[model samples]
Target: MRFLPFTLFLFSSYSLVKAGTLNKGDSCNIGDNRLQAGTYQFWSECNSQTYCGSSGKCETRGCRKDDFPFGYAPDDKLPEKCPKGQFCPDEEDQCQQIQPVGSDCQLNRDDQCEGPPNFKELADTSGRGLNVNGSVCLNSKCMWANATLGVACIVENTPYTAYGVDGEFIDIVSRGNCQLGLYCDAAQKVCMAEKLFGEACTADKECSSWNCLGSGVCGVSESIPHHFAIWVYIVVGLGIFGGMFGTLFGLYWTHRKQRDEEREKRMQYWREQNAFHQNLLAMRETARASILSLPGNGNSSARSTLYSRDGAFSDDVSAPILPNAAPKVSGLRHYLADDGSSEFDDGLMMQSGKKVDGRF
Candidate 1:
């Protein structure tokens, strides 16, 4: 018996989940006060082909695109276009009859107004059959095309509001209520001709040139001349190329200068090393010459006696004494001459070639 209650709850949840959207003539409620002015609400239970009417029931919508341009209704079920004598009102599910000239109307609802019956027949033969009738909603009233060029006109500055399918604010767009090929000048409050290039303008639509620059002047069209655009591209390309070339040239020059400076330093170092080596070679050559000029074949007894007596070469001795040359000196002639004693004796002995003590 307790499980019966649980089963009933499950069945109720399944039925709610399986329920489909409300069709025409089905009861629906959006849970809000929709009768209040400026209040809009969508009944989510109603299907796309119908809307919850004031009677609190889903009803067939008269128009789709004009009422719900943001896809609030089904495309296949709704009429493709509004009927000729009627127009769709914003946020309304029914099409209302077009109002006559001078009738009261809402701002920005120009479609609800009707044009002159003989407007097409009165046009010129070339413009006949064309849809050029200027019937617009101005100053909250339906009016015919009466404002001519340079004449006073009503310009609706209020932006048109667009709402989402759920009645959420989506966007707002500003539109002027003016005749064909003309726009209402907001500053002058008059119908004025579209401005040409270089003319002053406050909005883009006021210019025939198709563009209004930020300086409030009518500028040229967006499409630039092919030749002028090509020249601009060429100039930009040349600038980029010149910049890159200059950068690469500067880098190369700096690298070359660094390499040259390094080479010069290396050359200076090698030159100094060469000079040092040459000085060493010259000193070695002078030392070899002094050793080769020394007299050889001296008696060992006399050389030993001389060194033992002097202990070292005398300062007055001018002959260069080479290292390890003592054993090569055979006589005391060179040493005795430099000592300033027995020069004649040494000369006579060298000339006679005779031994004084049987060993010379």
Candidate 2:
């Protein structure tokens, strides 16, 4: 249980780190150089000063710039904040106050005042009213639109704010409100058919859900939910533990089987030893009986007399005979021939019961 918390913590940290990294299909900001998916890490080919964005697209714009005046490194300093009450506009990079709706304005230069195409005087009814194409300058507000999809429009009853041409809401909170199979067209300011991720785009508004990266291709964000990461960690841990347990169990079974075989072998050896001992005892008893049946008492001479002079058991032959009438030869052979036998024969008889003399 103590190890459980540690294990969970380790896996949880891994999951959080993994979730923070981008997957192959996940979206990314323009400045990020590293994208991670599963166990793989992908490095963006973006230039040194540029980075991938949250829109999953690379961007040269909005890149951090060196604040040499503040003695900061290149691309390290943050953007300056605007003064209170005045909002900073992205196009001008400056702070300004809101202007009256239907006011005359230059595109991108006076975003704080909000106006479209600098065509405030060009209207359908009165110059103060809506434009000929249903565009309005109610509050001098204008918005970016994807040219491929929807055009910019204003709500009839509300203040003049940016909306899709199809009448769906389009704002920071209600982004693109496009219908099924449609995408918000920032260029055309309308909802249009969706494009694939890698399609060429002039701006982030053209991609289906991904942003047009600095490399000119659509990309996704890298962030993921914590629950998903936790689940992945649990699964991986379980798999590893299961594998280890299975290996241990397999080894135990193999050892047990070997022990059983060795036990059986030992039992068989003991059985063989008992049988040999029994046979040896029976042989010993038979020899004792045979000795008891002998004619003389249990003496060494009686045992020796059981065999004749030639080592054959014969009770009829008493002793060897010597013939004195035989001629003796000279030397050692002379003495040996007097015994009625040659030296090679000694005094033994063949199995056919014939006397043998030394001859060719």
Candidate 3:
């Protein structure tokens, strides 16, 4: 049972170490492989009040504000303000007496110079912990911020480093030694106002518009408008609607015209057919009347007997004669005596004789 407690303690310690909550002098792995310039390389991370040193061990941190601000440090290790008459150095891990104006200092390392006494108080009250006091390290020397428009200034072309709470560098950037809203001119070597539109510019910072066109001129922002004018929308809508309507109407008109033409052709054809039928009926009637008006035979009774009640020839009648009929003389009859017989009667007798011969 006593060994059980010891085992539990060892397990707990092992779990704590595995959790990565390291302490001073504990071995750790560095965060990344690429080490930045002008910054310290630390192993993993250490607990509050300590930082990983070059020897790969945790060492006590010197100044809090210079290395780790309130939010940059661990939650429980919020940094405090630097002591009076002392300032933090960028390269060292200790606080030193503040440097007076005109003293030798490193560029972009403003922490080494003296600033407004109330800067800390203002930062705490304003909720923005920025070192924006008049003092700044410019051109490798401590100086008060005085780079106004038309004033001589130095343009630092080299990049400067910024450190994280663990004294590890995080960012590197180049900002010329000029006051706010001013930029150092590379050619004139003086601070100048930001350029207006259409002015020649080489960089975005040189223009108040923050836009440097490819033609090397300060120009308007290049943002494309996503919304069109109401009139444009209306015009486009009308155009589409008109196009559809015109297409439909054109098709309808064409179809209607075709149908009308077809109907007209059909009607005209029907009229022609009707007229032809009517003319044919009239011709038939005239033909019937002409046939009825012809001279009748002298033997009316005989002619009447040849036709039936329906005005057609009777089946019993073999031959019928007209009223204007004349006897035809045969040439052979000149050689013989005149028979005194009508041609019609002779033709009937001959036909009757032929019938009798056929039967025999």
Q: What TM-score does model 2 achieve against the real structure?
A: 0.26
What are the per-residue Cα lDDT tens digits for candidate 1 across 338-358? 545431233112333444434
Clashes of each: 3, 40, 2
Best by lDDT: 1
lDDT of 2 by residue, 1-360 (tens): 000001112232233332233333445554544433321222353433233455564443332222222213566645555554354332222446645445543322222443335333332232211232223222235332212235443221111122236863322211232333444443454666756677766444345543556777665622223355788989999999999999999999999999999999999999999999899767755754564454432333332344455555647455433353222122433333454533233321223344434321
lDDT of 1: 0.55
Compared with the true structure, what per-residue lDDT tens digits does model 3 show for residues 1-360?
000101112222222332124576787454422223333221235554555566766665566653433224355554455687776543234667878778886545565677655444322122111123656566677765556789898654433233336873323223455665567777788988988999988776587655677798888754434688999999999999999999999999999999999999999999999999899767755754563354542334454555444445557666656565533223433312244434222211112123221351
Q: In model 2, where do residues sit more than 4 Å from their true spots? A: 1-232, 299-360
List the global CA lDDT of all models: 0.55, 0.41, 0.53
Candidate 3 accuracy as TM-score: 0.37
Q: CA lDDT of 258 in candidate 3?
A: 100
**Candidate 1 TM-score to native:** 0.41
**Which ten-residue region of model 1 has the weakest summed lDDT?**
1-10
